[model samples]
Target: MKRIWKQVQQTLRILGAGILAILVLVSSTVPGGERLEQVRAYTRGVEFDYAGWMLAALWDKGQQWALSAPRYWDEKTQRQVVEDWAALTREVQALRAESARIFADPSVSDPQTAAAPVLARLRAREAEQARLGALSEEILQIQTRAVLAEMGLTYGKQAVPSVLYRISKLPLALVVSPREVIRQDANISLLPDMGLDEITALEQRVEQELGVSALVVQIGGVAVYPAMVMETTNLVYLTDTVAHEWTHNYLTLRPLGMLYDASPELRSMNETAASLAGKEIGLRVLERYYPDLVPPPPAP
Candidate 1:
C-alpha cells in the first residue's frame, strides 16, 4: 500500500503542475480567472479515475478485491435486498440531516468540528452503511448492467468485460470561485483514491498560493467526474447518472468531446447533449423496470 501510494503521489504532482499551467494560460487574464479555472477543471475530466494512470498501477490488487468479494444478494432475494437497502439508506440520510442541522446551530461551541452528538450520529450512520453494503454488491451488478443493456451500452469480453468495483468514489474536487465571488463554483476532479486529509490540504495550499477562492467538494454523483463504484437503491437517479457518465465516456472518443478543452462553448455543448441523451435513456429504463416512476412524455 505504501509503495502504491508513493506512486500515486508522484503522479498527482505531475498532473497538478501540468494542468495548472493550462488553467493559468486559458483566459487567466480575464476578470477573475474563474472561467479559465473552470475550463482547466472540465478538460481534465476524470483523468485520475477509472481510465486514469493512477489506477493502472493498482488495478490488479483492486480487481482481485472486487472479484473475490462474497455475494450476499441473489436472484431470489434481489427484490428484498433492494427494498431493505432503500429503507436503510433513507434512515441514514435522515440521521445525516439531523446531524447537519445540529452542526449548523450557531449556539453550539463549535460546529465545524464533530462534537459528542455528531460522533454519536456518525456511529449510527456507519451502522446503517454496513447494512446497506452487505447486499449492495449483487444489487449493483444486476441493476447497473440491466440499465446499460437497456440503453444499448454493452461490450463483449474482448472490448471490456465484467467491471466490478469494491468502493464508491473518493473525488478530491478542488473548487474555485471567481475572485470577485465568495463561494465555490468551479473545480478540477481528483483521483477516487486520494485521502481526505491529503485533498483538503491541497485545496488550502492552492487557495493560498493562487490567492483564489478554493475548497474541496468530497461528495458523489457529480456529472463532471467519474465514480469507480456506482450503486444506489434510488433507481431513478442510479439509472440516470450511470447513463450520464457513460455518455461522457462515449463522447470522449468523438469530435465534440475530443475538442472539449479547445473552447468553452464546446464543453457546454458536450454536457447539454449528454444530458438530453441520458434523460431519454433513463426514461427507457423507467418504462421497463419501474413504470410507475416514468414521467409522461410532453404534449405533442
Candidate 2:
C-alpha cells in the first residue's frame, strides 16, 4: 500500500511537470522582443498568477480523484445537479439585476435597505451554487472526453493530457498588434477583476509608448493546466469554450500546434483548426447528452 501511494505521487509530479512544460511552450511561442517586454512592464503588477492558480487547481483535482465523487453519482444525479445549477444561475442573475435596479433607482434613497432581500437570497444560494458548479464542471469534462474518445482523438483509452478545465472568473488578455498591420505580437494575461480605468490606462500606455494598437479584451477561456473558463450559465457556450481550449492543448503536442508561433499563417491555421474542432466536439457532446438544449439547424 505504501508503494502504491508513492506511485500515485510520482504520477502527479510527472503530470505537474508536463503542465509546466506546456506553459513554457506557450510563453515561448511569441518572440520576446523589446516591445513585448515594454508591454509586460505595464502589466507587471497586475499579471495573473499562473503558478499559484496551477497549484491550487492540481490540489482540487487530487481531492476529486480521491473522493471519486462524480464517478459514483449515477446519470440521474448528474443530470439533476447540472439542471439545478443552471436554474440557480438564472435566478442569481435575476437577483443581481434587480439589486442593481434598486440601487440605481433615484427614488430609493436607502439603496442598501431596498436591496437587502435580494442580497440575502444571493448569499443563501452561494454555497449550493459552489457545490453544483464544481460538479457540473467535472461532468462536462467527462462528457467532452467521451466525445473526443469517440472521435479517435484519444490514445490508450484516454484523451491525451486528459480533458481538464475549471469554470472561473477568467483573466483579461492584453493583445498588442502593430498599427502598420493587424497581427497579434503579444498577448498578456491580467487580473480578472482589474478595473476598467486601469485596463484603459494600460492599453493607452502600450499603444502610445510602443506605437502599436493595444486592446484589453475579455477572454472566455485560456489554455492553462486545467484550462481556465469564464463562469457562465449558458451550457452550450460553456462546453464549446472548454472543448476549444482543450483543442489547443491537444495541438500543443503535435507539430501544427507546436508551430503555432512560427508565423502569422501558422498561428491563424492553428486557431482556425482549434475553433472548428472545438465547435464540432461541443455539438457532439450536446447532441448525445443535452439534446433538448441543442440549437436547431439554420435555414437553407
Candidate 3:
C-alpha cells in the first residue's frame, strides 16, 4: 500500500512538470505569432481609412480648383488628374480588402492565452494609426487654407498686396512692404517658367528634391520619418510650418522615441507639441520682424 501511494505521487509530479513545460512553450510562441498577425490586420484597416480620406480630399480639391479656374485647367486635364487619383485609391482599397480577408479566416481567429502580449502590441499599432490619421487631417486642413490663400488672388480679390516679387539683377526678395523686405534664400522662387500642367510637374519635382535635402540637413543622414507638407505662403502658414518642422527636430532627441520607431501616437504627441510651439514662435517672429504683415487667424 505504501509503495503504491509513493508511485502515484511520483506520477502526478511528472505530469505537472510536463504541463508546465508545454504552457511555457505556448506562452512564448503565441504572443509573438498573435502580435504579428494582429499588426498586419490592423495596418490594413488603417491603410484603407487613410487612402479613402486622401482620395476624397484630392478629388474635391481638384474639382474645386478646376471649377474656380476654368481658364487655367481644361476639362480633359481635370478629369485625367481625378482619374489618376481614383485609380490609386482603388489599388489601396483592394490591398486592404485582401488583408482583411486573410485576417478574418476562422483558422487565424483561434486565440491562445499566451497571445496576450501580441494582443497588446496590436492595440498599440491601432492607436498609432489613429494618431497619424488625426495629424494628417490637421495638416491637410492647414494645406487647404494655404491653397485657398494662394488661389484667392486669381479666383477672388487679393486680400493683401503681393509680398513676393521678382528682381532682375538682384536675388528674389520676400517684401513684407516697400521698406521692410527680407532677403530670403536665393533659391526660393515661387514663379514657375511653365504652364499649369508643367508647373504642377515642376512643383512636385522641386518639392521632392527640397524634402530630401531638408531631411538630410535636419536629421543628419538618418532615414526620413513620415511627414506631410503644409503650405507656408501666409503668416499663419509660416508659423505652422516652422513649428511642425521643429517638432520633428525635438523627437530625434528623446528617449521614448528610441523604443518605438514608427508609433503614430508618439509622433502625434511630438507634432502637436511642436505645432503649438511653432505658433508661439511664429507670432513672436512676426511681431518682432514683420509687424505690418501680420494676418488674422483663419476661422476654425
Candidate 4:
C-alpha cells in the first residue's frame, strides 16, 4: 500500500512537471508556443472591467426576452428557406452598397431621381428578408427552448432569443495567425486566403522572417472561434454559435465569467462551457426542425 501511494505521488508529480514544461514551451519559441510573448504583452495589467458593457447586454437581453415571439410558417413556406433567403440577402446587400455609393456626395442635390430605384429595391429586399428572417428565428427559437428544457436552464424573464440568423460576411477582415485576435466592437478578421498554404506560408513567414514563433492553428472552416460573433453567414453554425455567445453573455453576471481573465483555466472553462451548451442547443435544433438529418434514435 505504501509503495502504491508512493507510485501515485510520483505519477502526479510527473503530470505537473509535464504541464509546467508545456507552459514554458508555449511561452518559448516553439511552433505551438509562439503566442507566449504576444500574449504576455497583450495581457499586461489588463483590468478586465467589462462589466459596464456586460450590464448593458444583460438589460438588452431582458428586453429581448420580453419581445413578441417570431411568427411560425408552415412546412410549405419553409421549404428552400435557406437558399432563397441567402439569395435575397445578397441582393439586399448589393442594393445597400449601391445606395450608399450613389448618395455619398453632399454637393449632389436632387438625388431622389438617381436614388429612387435603389432605395425602392433596398426597401423591397429589406421587407422580404425581414419576413424570411422571422421564420428562421422561429425555427431557431424552438431549438433554444428545447435545449433550455433539456438542461433545466432558465430564461429568467427573458423572452425567446431572437436568433434571426442571416449570412452576412463582414465586408472586411484583417486576418491573423495563431489566434491573436484583432477585434473591436464585435468585428474581427476573416481568413481571406484561397488555400491553406497561403495562410500557412503567411504564418511561417511571420515567424521565420520576424524571428518569432507562429504556427497555423489548424482551423479548417469558414467559422472563426470566439470571434465568430463578428459576422457570420453559415446558418448551420450560426444557430449554435449564437448560443455559444449568449452563454458568455449569460455567464457575464456570474462569477465564472467575471473571473475569465483572472487565469487561462477560467477562460478555458467559460469558453468550454459555452461551446458544449451551444453544440447541445444546435443538436436540439437538428432534432426538432431537421429530423431528416438526424440519425435514428437507439432502440431499447
Candidate 5:
C-alpha cells in the first residue's frame, strides 16, 4: 500500500512540473505575439499626426491664395471642390483625434521608450512626401503649359478650362488615369500602347485564378477600383496608396492585427491618414507649379 502511494505522489509531481514548463513557454511567446500589433499602432499614430498637420497647413495656404485670385473656375465646380476639401479636413481632424487616443492608451504598450526613433520615421515620411510633391508639381506645370500653348493657337490668349479627374473601377483592382479637361468615353483601345482586349482577358483570368474579388487599373493617370475610395495616378496619390497598403503589411506583423483582426475604426483611421497625406503632398506639388490653380476656400 505504501509503495503504491509513493508512486502516485511521484506521478503528480511530474505532472505539476510539466504544467509549469508549459506556462513558462506560453508567457515568453505570448508577449511576442502581441508585439507586432503594438508596433503597427505606433507607426500608424505617427503617420496620422504628421499627415493631419501637413494637410491643415496646406489647405490654409491654398485657401488664402485662392481667395486673392481672379474668379477663373465655374461657380458650381469651384464650390464642389471646396466642399470636398472641407470634408477632407474634417476627416483628417477626426483621424488625428483617434490617433492621439490610441497613443495615450496605457493598455497598448510601446516597448520602445525613446521617441527619437519614431521621430526619425516621421521625418522620412515627410521627406518622401516632399519629393513626390515636387514631381507632381513638375508634371502639372508641363500639362498647364500644354494647355496654354493650345489656347494661344486657338484664341490668342490663355483660357483655363475645367479640370476633371476620375478613377475607373474593376473588381479587386484600381487604375489611375490622367486628368482630363473635358469628359469623354475612355479610349480603352489606345491605353498604354498595349492590347486592351488582351490585357482585360488576362486580368480576368488572373482574378479567377487567384480568387480575388477585384483589381486596380490605371487609365491615363486615374485609379479605378471597386473599393470605397476614388483612385488616382498622381505620384502623390500613388505614394499614399502605397503607404496605406504598407500599413496593412505592417499590421499583419503585429499583435494588434492578430488579436483585433483589423477592427473597422482602426482601418478607417489608417486609410484616412494615408488619404490626408496624399492630398497634402499632392497640393504641395500644385502650389509649386500651378500657383494660379490654387484650391478654393472652405464655405462659411
Candidate 6:
C-alpha cells in the first residue's frame, strides 16, 4: 500500500512538471518577444499568477479524485446539484444587488447596519456556492468527457488532454494592436480582481507609452490546462465555454493548434472550429443530461 501511494505521488509530480513546461512553452510563443516584454513591464505587479492558479486547481482535483465524490452520486443527484448551483447563483446575485442598493442610498445614514442581514445571507450563499460550484464543475467535466468519447473525440476512452477546468473569476486579457493596422501584437492576462478604472488606466498607459492600440477584454474562458472558465449563472454558456476551451486543448496537440499563431487566418480557423465544436458538444451534453434546460428549435 505504501509503495502504491508513493507511485501515485510520483506520477502526479511528473504530470505537474509536464503541465508547467507546456504552459511556459506557450507563453514563450507570444508574438514579438520584445513587445511581450514591454507589455509585461507594465503588467509586472498585476499579472495573473498562472502557476499559482494551476497548482491550486490541481490540488482541488487531486482531493476530488482521492474521494471520488461525484461517483457516489447518481445521475439524478448530479443533475439536482447542477440545478441548485444555478439557482443559488441567482440568489447570490440578487442579494448583492440589494446590498449595493442599501449602501448606495443617500438617505440611509447607517448603510452597514441596514445591509447587515443581506451581507450575512450573501456570505452564507457564497459558501454554499463554493461547495456546489466545485461538485458541479466535476460533474460537468465527467459528462463532457463521456459525450466527447461518444463523438470519438477521445483516445483509449479518455480525452486527449483530459477534461479539466475550474469555474472561477477569469483573468482580463490585454490585447495590443498596432496603431496603423488592426492586428493583434500581444495578448496577456491580468489579475482577475482588477476593476474597470484600473483596466482603463492600464490600457491607456500601455497605448501612450508604446504608441499602440490596446484593449482590456473580459474573456468568458481561457484555454489553460485545467482551463480557466469564468463563473456565470447561465448553464448553457458555462457548458459551451468549457467545451470550447477543451477543444483548444485538443487542437494543441495537432498541427492546427500548433500553428495557432502562424497567421491571422489560422487563428480564425482555430477559434471558429472550437466555437462550432463547442456548441455541438455542449448541446449534446444538455440534451443527454439536462434536457429541460436545452432551448427549443427556432420557428421555421
CA lDDT scores, all candidates in order: 0.54, 0.80, 0.35, 0.48, 0.35, 0.84
Worst 10 residues of 6 by lDDT: 21-30
Best by lDDT: 6
TM-score of 4: 0.44
Model 2 stretches with alpha carbons more than 4 Å out: 1-31
Which regions of candidate 5 are displaced past 4 Å? 1-194, 207-212, 219-271, 281-290, 298-300
Q: When superposed on Cα atoms, how far off is each prediction in RMSD?
A: 10.2, 2.9, 30.6, 15.9, 27.6, 2.9
lDDT of 1 by residue, 1-300 (tens): 885675566445434432332233232212244554544543354334423422332343233334433233444466556567777777666767777787888897777565566667768877777655645544554455566675556764111222222335455566676578665445565666766777666667666666677766665444322224344557676656655655664565468766665555776898788788768776676675567767767799
What TM-score would you give candidate 6 relative to the actual structure? 0.89
Tens digit per residue, CA lDDT, model 5, 23-129: 33223222232333333232222221222222333333233323322234443444344334334444444544555665677776772343345555555554554
Flag clash pairs in model 6.
none
lDDT of 6 by residue, 53-81 (tens): 77677777767655556856899999999
User: Model 3 Cα displacement at 270 (Å)?
Assistant: 1.4
**Higher lDDT: candidate 1 or 2?**
2
Q: Write the per-residue lDDT of candidate 2 for residues 111-200, one digit (tens) a residue.
A: 999899999998888677877888887788878888888889898667877788887788888899999898888888888999989988
Runs in model 6 lying further than 4 Å from the true structure: 1-31, 298-300
| TM-score, prediction 1 | 0.54
Of 2 and 4, the candidate ahead on lDDT is 2
* Candidate 4 global CA lDDT score: 0.48
Model 3 Cα lDDT, one tens digit per residue, 26-56: 2321122333343333222222122232234
lDDT of 4 by residue, 1-300 (tens): 885565456434434433432233222211123344343332223212222322333333333334423324455455457447657777887888888877886866867778998898799888998676545544555456555666657655332222222223222222234335422111122233325765465556545554444443322222111112322345556667767655664564478855654555776798799889877777676666666655556599
The count of residue-pair clashes in candidate 4 stands at 3
Better of 4 and 5 by TM-score: 4
